[model samples]
Target: MSTQTEHPPAGGGAAGVAEPGQSAAPGATPRQTLTLLTVLLAVFVVPTSISGTAVALPDIGADTHATLVPLQWVVNAFNVAFACFTLAWGSVADIIGRVRAFGLGAGIYAVASLASALASNVIMLDVARALAGVGGAAIFSCGSAILSTVFDGPARGKAFALFGTVAGIGVGIGPSLSGVLVQGVGWRWVFALHTLALGLVLLALPVIARRTTEPRRQGARIDVLGSVLFILAMLLLTTAIVQGSQWGWASAGVLSLFAGTLVALALFAAVEKRRDHPMLDLSVLANGRYLALCLVPVAASFGFVTMLTYLPSYLTAVSGYSSGTAGLIMVLLTLPVFACPMLAAKLVARGVSALTLIYVSLGCLVVGDATLTLFGQNVALMAVAVPMLVTGAGMGLSAGLVDGQALEIVAPEKAGMAAGFLNTLRLGSEAIAVAIYGSLLATVLASRMRDGIGDFPGAGDPATVANEVAGGNMTGPASAVDASARGDFTDFLVRSYDSAFHTILWVLTGICLVLFLIIGALVRTSRDGREPSAATGSQAAG
Candidate 1:
C-alpha cells in the first residue's frame, strides 16, 4: 500500500482529527468550513443534476421535438459516460492530484451545463449531457476519495454519514426543484442553475485548505484499452436493451449489438486481468465482502433509481397530472431518502452490521416493488405513495451504509479507485435499469394496444395508434380515429400502461428478493469462517 503523510494547515488539523484550523476544537475555522462546503457542494449537486434532469425530460422532449428513443438517449448518454469514465478519473486523481482533477471536473461540468442549456436540438442536448457526465464522474470520484483520505475511524463514519445525508437531500429535492424551475422559468434554467452553482464553487476552490499529495505508485499506468473496451461494451449493451423493443428483439440490428457487447466485455475483462495497473483492480473481487458491497448497490439502484426516473413521467402521462403535480407526488418516493440515512448511520454506530442493514434494505425493496406493482393503476395516489416511501427508505439506508463499509475493507491509497468502482456499479446499474424498464414498458404497452385496438371501429391505422399510445401521447387528436372511439382508446391506453408497469415492477421485486437471499448466504458463510474480525463487529461501528 502507498503511504504519504498528509500535512495540516498552519492553523488547522487534518480531517476527522480536529476542526480545520482549530486546535483540538469542536468548531471549524473559516478555511476548514470553506473546504467542507466546497466538497459537500459538489457531492450534493451531482445527484441533484441527475434527478433534476429527469424531471426536465418532458419539457426537453416537447421543446426539442424528440421522440422516445432520443429522449432515452438524453438520459442514457450521461449515465454511460459517467459510468465508463468514473474509474479512469479515480485512477487519474491518484496519479495527478485530487484537487486538480476536481477543479477540472467542476470547470468542465459548468461549461457543459451551459452548452446543454443553450442546445438548439435534441442531438446537441444529448451530446452536451454526455460531456457533462465526464465532468460528473471526476467530481463524484474525487469528492468521495478526498473524504476517505481526510477522515479515519469514527470520524470517517460521521463524515460519510453527513456526505450521504447531503446526497440524499439533493436526490430528494431534485425533481421538485426542477419542476419549479421548469414551470416558473423554463427547462433551460435547470441546466443554467447547475452551471451557476458550479461556477461559485470554482471561485471558492483556491481558498480552500489543500491536503498533502497522495504518493504515486511506481511503473503505474492507466488501463486505456480496458476503459475503451468497457465503454464500448456498456454502450452496445445499453443500445441493445433500449432499441430491442422498437427494432424487434430478433432483428439483425439488435442481435449485432448484443454480440458486440459480449465481445467488448470479454475483451475488457481479459485486458483488465492482464494489465499491471488496471483502471479497476480485479483482485478486489476476490474479497467476498468487497464484492458483496459492490453488488448490493447495483441491485438496489436498479430498483430504486430506475423508479425515480420513470415515476414522474408515468404520473404526468398516464395519471393526467401536470409536470408540477407529478413532481409533488414524487415527494413520496424521495422524502425518506432524506431521513433514513441518518437513522441508518445511528444504527450502525450502535453496532448494527452493514450486512444486516443491506439484507433488511433488500427486503424493504422487494416489499416496496411488489406493493407498487399491485397498486399502480385503478387506485388512489395514496396506494402508490406508501410503496414509494418504503422503497425510498430502503434506498437511503443502503446507499448511506454501503459505500462507507466498502471503503473500510480497502487500502486508503486506493480509496479513489474503490469509490470509482463502487459508483461505476451504481451508475452502470442505473443505465441498464432505465434501458430495461423503458424497453419492457414500451414493448408491453405496444403489444396490448395493438391487440386491444384491432377490433375498435375507425381507430385509424393500428400501427399509428400503437405508436402514439406507447409513446404516452394518448391525448393527442387523430383524424383517422372517430371521436366516438376516443373513450375506448383512452381506456385501452390506461390498461396497457398499467399492465406494463406491473410487469416491470414484478421483475424488479424478483431481483431484489433473489439478491437478498444471495447476499444473506454470503454474509452467513463469511461470518462462519472468513474474515471473522469484519464479520463479527469490528467494521460495523462505522
Candidate 2:
C-alpha cells in the first residue's frame, strides 16, 4: 500500500492553498472549487466528443463513402482502444504523476481531434478515433485521482458529484452541438471545433501544475505481461461478440475468437493472481458491495448505449420524423442524465445509499424502456419524452457511483486498479450489449417480415424478395415489379421493423429486471454510501 504524506509549504497565497493531498490551514480556501471545474471540463470533453461524432455520422458516411459495417468500426475501434489502454494509463498516472499524465492525454486528444478533421477516408478517421481513445483513457484514469487528492469529506463528495454531472451533461449536449455544427458549417468543422477548446485547456495546464506537487513513488513496477493478456482477452471477446452475427455464431472465425478470449482471460487471471503488483486487483471482485455496484453501471450503460444507436433509426423509420428531429428527441433522453449526478449528490448528503439510488435509477430505466417498447409508434411525443427523461436521469445519477463503490473495497494505494477494473467491466458490458441487441433486432425484424408476408396470395419466394428489399437492393428488376407487389413489400418491411423494435424493448426489459435482482442480492445498505474509513482516520481492512 502507498503511504501519503503532506508537502512542506514552498511559499504562501493561493499557490499554497493546502497544495492538494494536505490538510488546509484555518480559513483556507479549498482547492475543490477550482479542481472541480477543471476535472469537470476534462471529463466532459470525451463524451461530448463521442456524441458529437455520432450525430454527424450520416454526413461522415456520405463524405467518406463508409458502409454501415465500416461506420460501426469507426465507433467500436475507439471504444476498444479506450477499454484496453485505460488500466495501463491509470497505473502510469500513479507512477509518474497525475498532472503530467493528464496534460499528456490532453495534448494527444487535441492532436487526434485535429487529425480527424482532415481525414479523407473511413480508415483514416478510425485511426484518429483510436488515438483519441488513448487520450480519453489518460484523462479518465487520472481525473478521479486528482479529485481524490484535492478534496476531502463533504467537499470531495460534491467534487465527485460535479464530475459526474459534467460527464452526463457532455453526453446530453454532444448530439445537439454536432447537429448545429453540421448545419452551420461542414461536417469536418465539427471535429475541427474541439481543437479550440482543447487548446485553451492545454494552455491552462501550467497554472494547474504549479498548484499541486505529486510526490514520487519508489519501486513501482507496471505489470506489462498482465496488461497484454488483459487487452488480448478484451479484443478477442469483443471481436467475437461484435462480428458473430455477420459471421454466423458457429463459424470457425467467430468460434476461434471466442475460444481465444476464454484462454486469454484464464491466463490473465492466473498471471494477476501471482503478480506482486497486478494491473488489476482480483481481490476487489470478492467485495460484495463493490461487485453489486459494478452490475448497475454495466447494465444501465449497456441499455443507454443501445438507445444511442437505435433510437434515431426508430424515430425516423417509425415515427415519421427527420434525422434532425430524431437527434432532437434523443436530447430528451439525455437531458435528465445531466441532472442525475447532482440529484444523487444531494440525496447522498441526505443519507441515501449509492445502491438505493442505483436501484431507483435502474427501475426508471426498466419502466422507460418498457413504455417505449410497448407504445413507441403509438405514443405522443410528450409521452415518450417523459419516460426518456426518467431513464436518462436514472443513468446519470448512477454513473459514477460504481467507481466510488469500487474504490471503497480496495486500499487507497489500489485506487487506480479499482478504477481500472470498473472501467474494464463497463467497456466489456457495453460491447456485449451492442452486439447482442443488434443481432437480436436484426434477426427478429427479418423473421417477422418473412412471416407477415408468407401467407399472402401469389407471394412466391417471399424470403428472397424480403432480403432484397431489406438489403437496400430494391432498385433494378425489383423495382420493375407491379405496384401491388411494391406496396405489399413496403408493408411487410414496416411491420417487420415495428415487431423487431417491440421485441428489442421486451428483451431490454428482461435484462433490466435481472439487473434489479442482481443489485438487491449484492449491495449492503449504507447511509449516504460513505464508509467514513478514509474521510476519518478509521482503519480500513487489508
Candidate 3:
C-alpha cells in the first residue's frame, strides 16, 4: 500500500471512502466501512461507561467519603479532556494513519476503562476518566475521518446518518443500561464490557483495514505549540463555564480564567499563523459558506443541550414522574434523533442541502418545544409523544448532515484536518450551549418563581414559603390564601414552575426562528456548491 503514489490516485484515495468520480481500483470490495462503524461506535464507550457511574454516585460517596466538588470533577474530568482533545486527535490522525491512531486510542480507552473499574478512590477514578477522554478523542476524531475516507456521495450521507443515529442511541441508553448492569451485578462490569468490545473491535481491525493500509502523505507538519495553546484556551473557557455557578461568578479566579482563555486563543492564532502545518487551518473558517454551516450546529446545540440538561428536572419536579420515567421521557427526544439522519441522508440525495434539513429539524424542534410549553399539561399522552418525536427527528437530522457535507467539501488529504476543525467547533458549541443555556433557564426559573410568589398576596417570607411549597407540606388552596393571612402557606409551586418553563420555551422558539432564516440563506449557497447533475456521472469533471 505504501508503494502506491504519495498523492491520492486520480479519483482514488477519497476521504473516508471511495466516491463517485473519485479514483478507485476496479471491482474493489469496500473494506473500511465496517471498520469505520466500529471506530465510531467506540466513541460511545466513555459515555456508556461513565453514565452508569453517575447513578452510583451516592454509593461511591458513601464508600469513599468524596466531597461534592471532587465528586463533580469525576464527571468534568472526562468532559474537559474529551472536548479539548477531539480536534487535536483528529489533526494527529491526519498526520499519522487513521487506523493506526484509532487503534491506539481504542487500546488506551480499554485499559483506562479497566483501571476505572478497579479504582479504589475518587482521585484514581478521575485520573482514569481523564485518560479515557484522551482515548475518546482518538476514537471520535478518526471515526469521522474514517467514514469520510471510506464512503462517498449518497453513501457517505447515509453512513454519517447511521453514525449519528447510533451515537444518539448509545448516549440515551447509557444510563438505563448502566443502571441495570450495575444492579444485576456491579458498576465495575460496565467498564469490563467496554474492554470486551475493545477486544472485538481490535480483532476486526485487520479485516477492516485490508484495503486501506496505504499511508497518506499530507506534507503537513504537526503544530504542537498551537495545539498546546488551544488546549489551554479550551480548558480555561470550559472550566470557567462549568464552575461559575458553584463559584462566585465575579470571583477573581473566574475572571482570571476568562482572561486566560482570550490570551491563549490569541496566542494560538499567532502560533498557527507561523506554523508550516498548523493543527487547525484557520482559513477554512474564512469561507462564509463554511462559517454559516458551522453556525448551524453551534446555534441549535443551545436548545439541544438545554433540553437535555433541564427537562429531567421538569419531569421529576412538575410532571410527578420518577427518575426512571424521566429518563424514559427523554428517550422521546433522543430516539427520533437516530432515525432523522437516515431521513436526512435520503433528502440530501434528492438535491436537498444538508443545511436545509438541519434547519427543518431545528424548526421541528421549536414547534415541539413550543407545543409542550403552551399545552403540555392539557395534551394527552399521544399528543405529548408527537412533539417528542419531532424533537428527536430534528436532532437526528441536524446532528450528522453538516459533518458529512463539510468533509465532502475538502480534498482527501485534508480530511483529517477538516474533521478536526469541524469536530472542535461542534464540541465547543455543545459544551458552551450546555453551560450557557442551562444558566439562562436557571435564571429564568428563579426569577419567575420569585416574581410570581412575591405577587401572591399571602405568600409571606418568599424563601420559607417556597421551601414549604416545594416540600409538598403546604396546606389550603393556593388561591384561597388571603393577601394578609397567607403568610408562608401558599401552595402553587408546580404551577409557577410551569410558567417558568413556558417562558423558556418562548425563548427557544425565538432563537430557532432566527436560526431558520440563517439556515434558509445557507441552503441557497450549499446547493450552489454541490456538483451539478451533469458532473455527477463518470468523472466529477472538476
Most accurate candidate by lDDT: 1
Stretches off by above 4 angstroms in model 2 are: 1-17, 20-30, 58-72, 213-218, 455-481, 524-542
Residue lDDT tens for model 1, 438-523: 76677666676676677667665555565565556777623446778778767777777777778888898888888787776665
Candidate 1 clash pair list: 11-21, 12-21
Residue range 367-431, candidate 2, lDDT tens digits: 88887764445568886777778767667878765555455444544555556666667767877
For lDDT, candidate 2 versus 3, the one ahead is 2
TM-score of each: 0.85, 0.85, 0.85
The sequence of per-residue lDDT tens digits that candidate 3 reaches over residues 260-323 is 9999999999988777778877665544455565666665565565676667776666667777
Q: Where in model 3 is the C-alpha error above 4 Å? A: 1-30, 50-52, 213-217, 350-353, 375-379, 451-490, 519-542
Error (Å) of candidate 3 at residue 329 is 2.7
Give model 2's TM-score versus the native structure.
Answer: 0.85
Question: Which of candidates 1 and 3 is the stronger one according to lDDT?
Answer: 1
